[model samples]
Target: VISSFKIADIGTVDLDTIGTVEAGGMTVEVIDPVADYAELMESLFDFDALRALFKSGFRMRFDAMHAVTGPYAKEILENRLGAPNGTARNFIPLPDFGGHHPDPNLVHAKHLYDEMMGPDAPDFGAASDGDGDRNLIIGKGIFVTPSDSVAMLAANAHLAPGYKAGLKGIARSMPTSGAADRVAEKLGIGIYETPTGWKFFGNLLDADMATICGEESAGTGSNHVREKDGLWAVLLWLNILAARGESAKQIVTEHWAAYGRNYYSRHDYEEVETD
Candidate 1:
């Protein structure tokens, strides 16, 4: 038996199955994974606090890139959290992602980036990848690098009910910047540097040694689940925003002032022939 995930591969499957899909018809038990996931998400934060952010008229724009997270964002951010209608854009999952790649980076999600940088931008803007594990964060006129995001999230995570006790430790992929390391230092918690994969962080998380883990690839999560969760990161950010009563830019600026900022960048090359 083979199990597959992510839109890149899953979209190719023959979804319309006839009765007896395989030898001796397999029983398909349908379940509402979205409701289950939404419940789990709500458990991780102070509901009233997050609702207050929206109640206070702080606008949020989440671009799903027409990928998997559209429904989840719609349910959590709009239905559950009381955000205004149309808060989640490109919210219908399309197999071909409307003829464009569904990566939530500046290159692919450029429309969202442009809107966030525009003069009439919302207070907060975010995007998630097709598979719904990676994310992109932009605030009004500022783009929060994944490296700095991890650090900032780690610093303010306590504002969320799930992490109110504080993080046990922080783990980052090897290529990730040392920004999180500074956060770990200031918090006096353990810091781990592992290879570039979620699997490596799993062990540390299971051991209770690391409460939060992240990669510069825009993946971030906690011990709450094994794999990185994109909406989870978004909700946590909202929880922090609500508790702080500050704009995304203000929080980021203050985080830099407190931790001393780290400037960094990366480049990727494709089709390089190696001997």
Candidate 2:
């Protein structure tokens, strides 16, 4: 297979293992085989589409981990958010310092939590699990449950850069807290509750009828991707920050002070047998 060959063994490989080749400085390189069709389709997204979307005020939310993909997502968000030179500090990338785990939570992501609570903290602070799918939302000294986060996004949708086009609908996973339903009710918009997996929301998002989808496990995203994204939620929070001209903490504090504090929490049990 193509993966079995070393960089130097490209030219010596037989036809069956060959994919593609390039020659430079007396060296031949073989390309890895295509992993999946969907990846190829995703690569077809053009830079101009991003530029146009950003110009029209399209934004992204995402979670940042220590992995390379996290930085890649940040770069994309900066470019779309009109940051100069494609650099922004709202969701700055922290190095894998002191063997830290990049998960986003009060228990596991203490560094980010501390910063968010401190003076001069970022307008928004967000983190992702190892794979950049899970998210934790923090605003000035408090953590937002994913249910509240997604609902807040819906309630504040019109304040986002591009959401003036208006949200088509809202959706949440079955286990998610029911906050978004209130937002939907207030806005006179549709709300859908599906199974735990994000894939079930595909039909709604694909229909251009839903602008946000979230799960109770700290996962959130918009119509941007079919999968739940931590960083995407972060960017959405920043979009609100930019629009409101408020710190993350201030915004959430105002929210709770007005909403009377839902006081939501979760408990998990391990190895429970269904039988």
Candidate 3:
């Protein structure tokens, strides 16, 4: 397979396999499809257990407001999920994005909502738009609300290792707010609503019924790749904060003290001139 994707060795690693990776001697170049979707996020995210649970007191930020996933969030959150080196802000992929307005909300990523509500912020913060497929969750003073970010990433998608064999049903779109219909009624499964793009969630993700779907505009996703990724909802909320060491404002205040919140509102009519 091109000499197993030719790599004359250099700390070679490929933990689970998604496709294309060869080092020094060449071949790790898929070059597009956003670096082959960052090699399918290094074969569906572990990032060396999120760089060993973020090696010593974590901090994370990702703006990419300059648009188009600013070089795939600086090559997958500071070169494969360790998340350091200026933590990927505005990382530069401008094509008028330099004019700002990449639209990750909180009023156009208000400088990543003022450095994630400041105080040397960064225990997690995010933004994505202008074709990365829209996402905007922030946590160091918290701001989730994309219908509770798909009900807190489908209730922590079993601490994410490609969803750890859970979630076979769950979808939303009809204004998305009952907080993923209370995590599909506490995981009893099957809950669809469909009606806002995502092609009506492609037949409940091709008849598996659903694997997770969302929208309240910020968007969540599933069926692995039918769209609405936005860096796979920030790597499934950083694999549910490295498998629940917790924080993202203590998992949305313990998911609203175990499911007891679902607020909704929206009304826009920008630039109307038909008198």
TM-score preference between candidates 1 and 2, better one: 1
| Model 1 CA lDDT for position 98 | 85
- Model 1, residue 171: what's the lDDT? 98
lDDT of 1 by residue, 1-275 (tens): 66876433222223454333232234443457778899998889988888887988989899898999999999988898899999999999999998888888888888888999998999999999999999999998999999888899999999988899999999999999999999999999999999998999999999999998999999999999878988888888888888988888999999889888889786756359876
lDDT of 3 by residue, 215-247 (tens): 888877888787787768887888788878888
Q: How many clashes in each structure?
A: 0, 10, 0
Q: How many times do residue backbones clash in model 2?
A: 10
lDDT of 1: 0.88
Which regions of candidate 2 fall more than 4 Å away from where they truly are? Answer: 1-63, 73-102, 119-122, 257-261, 268-275
RMSD of 1: 5.8
RMSD of every candidate to native, in Å, equals 5.8, 8.6, 19.1
TM, every model? 0.87, 0.65, 0.29
